[model samples]
Target: MLEIITNNRKKATLKYVRAFLFFSLILLILFMLFITGVVIYAKSKGAPPLAVPQSTLIYASDDSLIGETHYGEKRYWVPLDEISPAVVEATLSIEDRGFYSHHGFDYKRIVGAILADIKARAKVQGASTITQQYARNLFLTHDKTWHRKITEALYTVRLELNYTKEEILEGYLNTIYYGHGAYGIEAAANYYFGKHAKDLTISEAALLAGIPKGPTHYSPKVNEDGAKNRQQLILSAMVENDYLTKPELETISSQELNYTFGSTKERPVIAPYFQDEVKRLLASKLKLDQETINTSGLRVFTTLDPELQSIAEEQITQTIAKDSEIQVGFIAMDQHTGQVKAMVGGRDYTESPFNRVTQAERQPGSTFKPFLYYAALEKGFTPSTLMRSEVTAFTFDDGRERYVPHNFNNYYANDKITLAQAIALSDNVYAVKTHIFLGQDVLVNTAKKLGITSQLASVPSLALGTSTVKVQDMATAYSTIANGGVKQEPLLIEKVLNHKGEVIYESTPVKKQVLKPEEAFVTTHLLTGIFDEKLNNYTRVTGRTVMDQLTRHYAGKTGTTRTDSWMIGYSPQLVSAVWTGYDRDKTIDLTAEKTYAKEIWASFMEKAHEDLPVLPFRAPEGVVAVQVDPDSGLLATKKCSEKARLTYYVKGTEPTESCIGKAEITNEEAPKEADEEEKKGWFKRIWDWF
Candidate 1:
């Protein structure tokens, strides 16, 4: 019996030991799994967030950042070293008092919070240390679940093991959302104080730090009163933790903050549509993916001049207001470099974003006359070439019917006019006659060579701007003339650099010789006469009187197409184009004024060139100036009326002989005053009086 009892005791002891070993193995496996999860979760965190790209915020040469066109969100990541130390202290004192002493997870605080929750029969508070909160923000969502809590703790431990304390703290401060479309301290500083995080005051820093606790609930945007209350609570916490003395806390709390609750106003709208164009071009031509172009944190240096952009904006706005029906678009470029210096896509970006300067395709109207004359010039037709400006019709086979173009006045003169005279007066009959002389195909070819990329027809009416083209393209075409016949493609962004300051793309202007130097010179000379002599004779207007105050010498053209208005021209220094029409092709109310384009052009040119030196068109090296009859397009004689004709000369290409009696040098004299008085009867006199 004694031996049997001893055997039973030994068997029981063995069984207990076996049970202990199995339980120990299970615990060991669970710990290993937990550690593995922590490692994996830490590696799965999203990247440290960045601010909107610099390209979206274009800056002028003077370092003034232009129009803001940001998407996604505005966040400026700042390192802990860059933040004010007071902000860090204030945040820790309020959000996590034991941040410095605790590890990633604080066991004592967790136990206390749990006990409090049990007593209240509900969860009352959180025990997230600063590092734990940052870990959650970086890796986890705002989920109230045991699994998420466990994951948060694991991520916190992993972060503590891998990163320094300062790095974690910086990550926390920068990754926290502050409501109001702001996602970080830097963004909060900009939104609330209109300044950088580094430049924030102690009060401002404390206020921002108070927000991440409950951004929307305590947001300055939503609950200004709650935000102030939370700010005071932070101040109290700071005092208790010795971050701020009681007296200092009292002083700060009592002071009025005067904070503005919105985005920063430091950046202004210099060029709205231009910036849009830059972004599109960068994404398309450079083959940069959207993420890299918009979020890779690049700095795009553009060719916009804030001064010039401002001038263009002011001109369009003022002109549109004066004539409410006219909505204007303009582009001004440097003739030498093809750099688009200034542009106004519309009167106001917010009012309309059509961006006529780059997108809208309106009829060129008479502004296209230059290209027609250019075609004639290339076909052995000098400015002196004569055409019969009489009414004529042409029939073409377009599967429908023939089209006959007409002059604006709907009347035709059967008399012969020089090519220069035809262009100056903008006579449609003369232009169509010339187009017929040089077949439509040849004219289209010449226009294409002059930088017109718009599709053209083989029909005669195409010479009248039937081919659609953008204002930018038209500006490019005029630039060729201003550049002495070399077409330089317009460029906005000069270069783009990546986040690491490596250049991703650079613009090298493409120069295509479009016209001979002589052809361009002759074009310029003839267009100048339009504004100076013949148009003046017809309306007693002259270039000197149109913008008589301008000290700089320039040549330009004004055009209007029923509902559309345009003014495209060039000086030796700059080439510019301006258009005005309604958003939905509404008719512009020009009243009775004939020179609708001329008004805006004169105002803009005056203001634009106010600070620029008065510079004249630089004649080429071999060019020479000689007096010629602008009316008859020949060498001037004394019989040519000084009022009826003027002089412009091209280098190495002057008239060989004087035009003694080339053609009528003056307008057909109107009926004599005595004859009109005699012809008027009693009824006519009564109608005149009435």
Candidate 2:
């Protein structure tokens, strides 16, 4: 009976063992099928195209790099050979110890991470290998979720299957964020250490490698202590992984590493304001948002002249009061093409990003007078037209108060002054009277035609330049006069190329004849009168300083209001406008000593025209030069005093009548005049003898 029971027990044990084997075989088959499905799915997805955020490069007219615009990620790709071996070792040691040995994921590290998380009762540890990290960075979101994990695993498998270990490491290093607007190992090394990735020391490489775990917390600029701590851990791991000896690790850890603070130092921007203007222009022309402009990897060729831009920025910095709250805006453009050659939007763009050249609108003051004078010229008024410079008041048809205008310092001659003299003297009363006589609507229309798009009040004050306009528009307006009445829209960008260097868009200046050549020439001549020392007393002419420095034939106007001061002028080749004022609408006293606009304008214009030929303003057909009396609009005669000056007039509009001299003896009474002189001489001789 015992033998039989033992045999049955043995049989039962054998049966249990066979059943266990069968179940194990079924489970293995199921696991194999699951793995096969994952592999197939990942293969179908294929390796994601290696896409990295790229920066748009802006180049000056000389083909020098001016600026770069980036999206959220700022990265620069480099080949695997360019990376330092120390950087590779540090990254592998801290990020994934079993990177070379694992297929896609390290199961031992994964199990250890899971146990650690269970002990901590929170998902505080990450077991993502380098491949998994690259997969997430390239294709998956960073959210902590089972779905994202699965997707990351699938992408990791594909990455491992398609790319070599070196390729995977290269992609991983190039895609990791390193804080402070820096992405990728190359950008990180350059930004923080001011050196290339291939030149990184072991300590620097360790610090950079530690940044990927928590870039913000490990940034050396933000938290040096935390970064040092993480760096020490990375160095220790490097030594433990046989990447460095104990003594070598000690020596590297003891060496001090210097770092640069900002990303701009790594990649310098040559013309920030001009670059911004280009971006804005591109945005409008392409119908794309600013984000796309920054991230599209476009190669923008701008119209900016780097030399002129340097001069502009330097002149503005030197001319503005050091301790004052005043701000200045400047812009220079090519008269023929309307290409913006140089621009300084403000004293410092960092303090105020408001681009006064293209955005801010302030009262143009007397700068708006040229348009008014141009309107008068269009209305058959010549430069010699007589206008009253006395104080004048106008009552508006609308229920507003009466508008009374005064000349600067209440110093008008209160006499009949030729339009040329009025322009040279910037007589406010004369301008207002001319505006009213020619019709206010005419001046407004003329301003709009000249490219002053800012709103202008229809009141008579518009003649006195109470209308607000941008410096860019003012520059364009003067450029129109310089370009022989052809108004070309201001252009900032020359051409835009895609990442592959294909021309995507190019600028063709929008141009139209806004004024007759004769009219524009007459107006330009009148503007030149402002710099005439003889026409003015050489004292109060607003553009006298510019005239003193500039040798070329140019025309300009100086404008001063309670809150703004401007010097907008142009040569036949270049046109520029300089505006100085406070950012807030507070009254600023722009005395001769405080008027930086004219000073800066003179400095920049003189430097800009240094290499160009001295070209005189050519008078177009139908425009004639004639001498005229200062007090009368008529032509000059021998009887007229020396105040008579040469003036330009549109043909048929010149003064036809000659000036009549003061009352005196006529030619018929020449003999009687001689007898009177003889009698006076005899009487004087007798008195002297007595």
Candidate 3:
């Protein structure tokens, strides 16, 4: 009976062993099939293109490279032979010991890592080889998930099968990111040592190799001690791997490494103000955030003219007063296309990044007069219309306050002056009178149509430029007049190209007709009177200092408040605005000193128009010029003096009555006009008298 039991146990043991063997074979076959399927899928998908972050180039209108925008990773690709062998050996020793022998993974290291993780009850160690790291950097994110790991494994197999060891290492070296806005070994070498990768010493190579593990924590700029310790650890690993002898390691470790830091001074950015504006416009146009703009590898083509921009910067530096604590904002735009060619947000961009051109809102002073005068023109008031320039007080509806308006010098004309003379002299009383004569809402609507978007007060002071507005908006509003009644949106970027140089976006000017051609011409004609020597007598005129510098026909206005000074002018082709003031709204005595705004504007405009053709302001149809009396705004007769100036007027609004000076004022027919004026209300009588 005992022998029978032994035989049965042996038979059962053999059967159980056979069953275990069969099950193990099936499991192995399934695993092999799963790997085969993954490989097939990866092969069908093909290797992903290397997507290392690259620097975005910004080109000017002339196609010259002006600036570069980049994410934290700035890379320059190079071949394997271009890298030093010392770096390759050091990297291999510290990162993957069995890189040369492994197919796609190291099972021994993976098993050891798994055991260590199990003992620690957390994933404290990683067993990723160089191939795995390359796979992750190439095609996967650093997300800790089984799905990502499986995908990484598949990509690793694909990498190993598709490229040789040297090719893989070259790609790995080119794709790894270093710190301080550097990616790839070549960029890292140049950024840190100011040399090529092939010229690196063994110590430098080991130091660079140690940085790929943790770029921020091991950066020599951040922690020199930590970087040196990590470098020593890499060197010891190289010694253990037989890649370096002990004596060689000791000699290399003893040598001090020289490093160069990346700074703006080293790589100067050209047209920084314009570049920043382009970035902001690009963000809005593409609906992208700052991070995406820095990293998406876009090629931005801007409307900036490098020569013009340089001229603008130089002129600002030369014209701004040295002893003043005032800041300035300036911008130039093409009249027709509204392309912003040059912009200086402040006197010094490095001192403050606030873009005053497009960002800051300040009182525009007398610059708001043009819009009010334009509103008057729309209300059938000709440039030849006469208004009183004497002191006028406007009482509020509640009778709580009264605004008494006066001229800059407190010296009113004390007589009726033509509308053109009011603008030329910048008479605040006439402006306030016109603002009250025309509806307040009419002025606001005209301002809005002309591109003044800031909040405006609807009081009589609105005509005196009491509203705050951006310098850029002022440029646009003046550009409308320069463009002959057409309003075009301000444009900064011309086009945006993708990484492959394909045009992804192109900008076309958005235009709208906001005024009658005749009306705009009349307004522009009125503005030109400010620079007229006959009208100004070359004295006390706001822009009189720069009038001699103009070689072509241009119209402009000078605006001043207690804290601000502005000069906005434009030719047929270009429009520019210059604003000078203290940033903290400190009171400035613009009347006590020479106007820097006009000086800067004149300097920049003179330099900007040097090579361009001298274009004249073309008169549109339905506009007529008539010689009018300066005092009476009536037709010039032989009795009128030589001061009668030829002024532009709409076809039907030209003065018909002749100016006979005091004789006609006291004529026998004056009693009929007085009897008719006495029958009207005070407002109607004032309106009809003008």
Please, what is the whole-model Cα lDDT of each candidate in the order they appear? 0.72, 0.84, 0.84
Better of 1 and 3 by lDDT: 3
Full candidate order by lDDT, most accurate first:
3, 2, 1
Q: Count the backbone clashes (under 3 Å) in each candidate.
A: 2, 0, 0
lDDT of 2 by residue, 357-442 (tens): 88999999998999998888888677777656667677878757798898888887766677888888898877888888787799
| TM-score to native of every candidate shown | 0.76, 0.70, 0.73
- Candidate closer to the true structure by TM-score (higher is better), 1 or 3: 1
Q: In candidate 2, how many Å is residue 126 off?
A: 13
Clashing pairs in 2: none
Q: Which stretches of candidate 3 lie over 4 Å from their true place?
A: 1-35, 41-50, 76-136, 139-153, 157-181, 184-265, 398-400, 537-539, 590-594, 637-641, 661-685, 688-690
Q: Tens-digit lDDT track for model 1 on 217-333? A: 987778888988988888888889888899998899887786777645654566878887888888888887776666555667889988888877776666555646566778989
Q: Candidate 1 at 235: error in angstroms?
A: 5.1
Candidate 2's C-alpha runs over 4 A off are 1-74, 77-133, 141-149, 156-173, 177-181, 192-306, 348-351, 392-404, 413-415, 494-508, 537-540, 583-585, 620-647, 651-690
